[model samples]
Target: MPRTSTAVIARAKGAPVELATIVVPDPGPGEAVVRVQACGVCHTDLHYREGGIGEDFPYLLGHEAAGVVEEVGPGVTDVAVDDYVVLNWRAVCGQCRACRRGRPWYCFATHNATQRMALADGDPQAGTELSPALGIGAFTEFTLVAAGQCTKVDPAAKPEVAGLLGCGVMAGLGAAINTGGVTRGDSVAVIGCGGVGAAAIAGARLAGANRIIAVDLDDRKLATAQELGATHTVNGRDQDVVAAVQALTDGHGADVVIDAVGRPETWQQAFYARDLAGIVVLVGVPTPEMRIPDIPLLDVFGRGGALKSSWYGDCLPSRDFPLLIDLYLQGRLPLEAFVTETIGIGDVEAAFAKMHGGDVLRSVVTL
Candidate 1:
C-alpha cells in the first residue's frame, strides 16, 4: 500500500520549504520503507533549496536521519521490519571498480530507491516527482530507501543523535580518523571549528593525539571545540594561522593539519601549517567556481606528505556506523552535543537561518 507522508519540500530555487504531502509507495524489490524517528537539519538541505547543489527544484530535503524499518521488500535480508537503523546515503555496490579494488569507501556506484516519491494531489507542486536530496529524503514521517541504506544500530542510541552519523558528523569524524589517520601522540590542528571541524577535533582526541589545536573565527565554536577535546584554540581572525600553529607545536608545526573550511586560502594554510612529511586533509566542500591561487607548484614537491580530499570522510557505512554508535553509547563520543536543538518538521526553514548565522550546531527535526 502507498502512504502519504508530510515532508519538507522545496518547490523552486530560493523559495521557502513547505510542509507538503509526499506519496511514498510500498517498498519494491531490494527496498525498504522506514518510519523516520529523527532527521537533522543540514546545510545541504539549504544548498538544495538555494539551487546550490542543482536545479532539482522539487527537492525532498533532509538526509541525516535515523528510523525503524516498518516494511521490507522481497529479497531484502540486510535489515528486517522493526529494526532500529541509521539511514545512509552511500549503499555501495559490490561490483564497482573501487569496491573491487578493496576501497569500498570510494565506491563509484551507490544505491537509492528506484521509485520516486511523488508530490500528492492538491498541493501546488502536485504531480511533481521529487528528487530526494542525497537519495535519503527523510524529512518526512515515512521514507522508502534501498535496503542497504539502513544500517542497524543499538536501539538505546538516541534517534536525534544517531541520525547525524548519516552525514556531516560522519564526514567530520572520518576526516580525522580515516582520512587524516590521526595517531597516538601526534600533533593535529583543525582549521574551522564548525560541526565538521569540531568532529575532526573529537576524532583526533579519540585517536589519542597529544595536542589538538582548533582554529575558528567564532569564540562560541572554539568553546565547543574545546569541549570536544581541543587542547588549544586559535581565533583565525586575530592570529596568523600558520605562525600560531607552528608556535603551538614548538616550531615544528603540527604533524597533521586538517582544513574543515573548503576555501583555497584555508587549504593553503593547511598546506603550510604542517611539519615536513606531515599529512593535510581537506574535508570541507567548496563551490564549483572556487579555485586555489598563489600556491607555488614547487612547495608541493618540497613538502612531502599526502594531500587528500575527504569525501564523506572516506567512510564505509557498514563498518563505521555501528562502531561510532557504540562509542557514543560508551560515552566516549559526545554525539548528543552535536544536536543543539530539536524542532518540528516545519522548523527547518528557521533552522536554516540559524545555520546561516552560525547560531546552532544542529537543529534536528523530531518526528
Candidate 2:
C-alpha cells in the first residue's frame, strides 16, 4: 500500500523549499523504503531549488542521509528491515560493463526506484511527480530508493555523522584517497576549503600524506581545514596560489593537487600546482557554461601526469562507508567536526541561508 510522508520540495525554480505531503509507495522489486533519521543540507540542494540542475520543476531535495531500513521489496537482499544504512545515489548494476570489468565504482548504469513519489491528494499539486535529487531524494520522513543504494554501516555511529558519507564528505575523502592517490609521504594541496575540501584534507591525513596544504579564499574555512588535518594553509586572496603551493612543497609543487573549487581558474591553478609527473584531481562541480581552462598545449604535454575528474569520488559505497564508519567509531576520523549545527525540517530555509554566508559546514536536519 502507498503511504504518505512529509517531505521538503521545491515547486518552482528560485523558490523556497516547502514542507509538504508526499506519497511513498511500498518498495517494488529491487527497492527499499528508508525511515530517515537525519539529512544534511548541501549546496547541491540549493542548486536544485534554483533549477540549476534541470527543468524538473518539482524536485525532492536532500540526499546526504542516514536511516533505518523499514522494508525491503521482493528480490532485495542487499539490506534488511531495521538495518542502519547510509543512502547513496549510485546503485551499481552488476551486469554493466564497468561492473563486469571489476570497476563497479565506475558503473555506467546506476539504478533508482522506478515509481515516482508524488504530491498527495490534498495539495494543489496533487499527483505531480517529483524528481528526487541525485535519485535518492531524502529530505523526508521516509524515502524510497533502489535497494542497492542502502549501504549498511555500524548503528553505533550517530546518524548525523555517518550520513555525511552519503555525499559531499565522501566526495572529498574519495577525491584524495581514491582519485588523487595521496599516499604516505606525498604532498597534497587542496583548493577550496569548503566541506568537501576539508574532507579531502582529512582523507590525505588518513592516507598518510606528509603535508596537506589547504587553499581557500576564506580564513574560517581554512581554520576548519586545519582542524580536519591540514598541515599547511594558503589563502588564495593573499598570495599567488601556485607559488604558495610550490613554496609549501619546497619549490617543485605538491605531488597531488586537488581543485575542489572546479572553476577553470582553479583547475588551471591545480594543473600548475603539481610536481612534475604528479596527479591533479578535480572534485568540484562546474557550471554548464564553464569551459576548459585555456592552458598552453605545450604545458599539458610537458607536465606528464594524470589529470582526472572525480565523480562522487569514484567511490564504491558498500566498500567505503563501512570502513569509514569504523574509523569514526575508533576516533581516528573526526566526522563530528563537520557538523556545524542541527536543525529541524522546518529550519531548512534558514540552514540554506547559513550555507550562503559560509558560516556553517553542514546544517543537518535531524528528525
TM-scores, one per candidate: 0.99, 0.99
Off by over 4 Å in 1: none
lDDT of 1 by residue, 1-367 (tens): 8999999999999999989998999999999999999999988889999999999779999999999999999999989999999999999999999999999999999989999899999987687999999999999999999998999999999999999999989999999999999999999999998888988999999999999999999999999999999999999899999999999999988999999989999999999999999999999888899998687789998999889999999999999999999999999999998999999998999999999999999999999
For model 2, residues 1-367, the per-residue Cα lDDT tens digits are 8889999999999999999999999999999999999999999999999977897979999999999999999998879999999999999998989999999999999989998899999999999999999998899999999999999999999999999999999999999999988899999999998889989999999999999999999999999999999989999999999999999989999999999988999999999999999999999999899999888899989999999999999999999999999999999999999999999998998999999999999999998
- Regions of candidate 2 where Cα sits further than 4 Å from its true position: none
- Report the poorest 10 consecutive residues by lDDT, candidate 1: 292-301
The superposed Cα distance between candidate 1 and the true structure at residue 105, in angstroms, equals 0.9
The number of clashing residue pairs in model 1 is 0
Candidate 2 global CA lDDT score:
0.94
**True-vs-predicted CA distance for residue 146, candidate 1, Å:** 0.9
State the number of backbone clashes in model 2: 0
Which pairs in model 2 have colliding backbones?
none
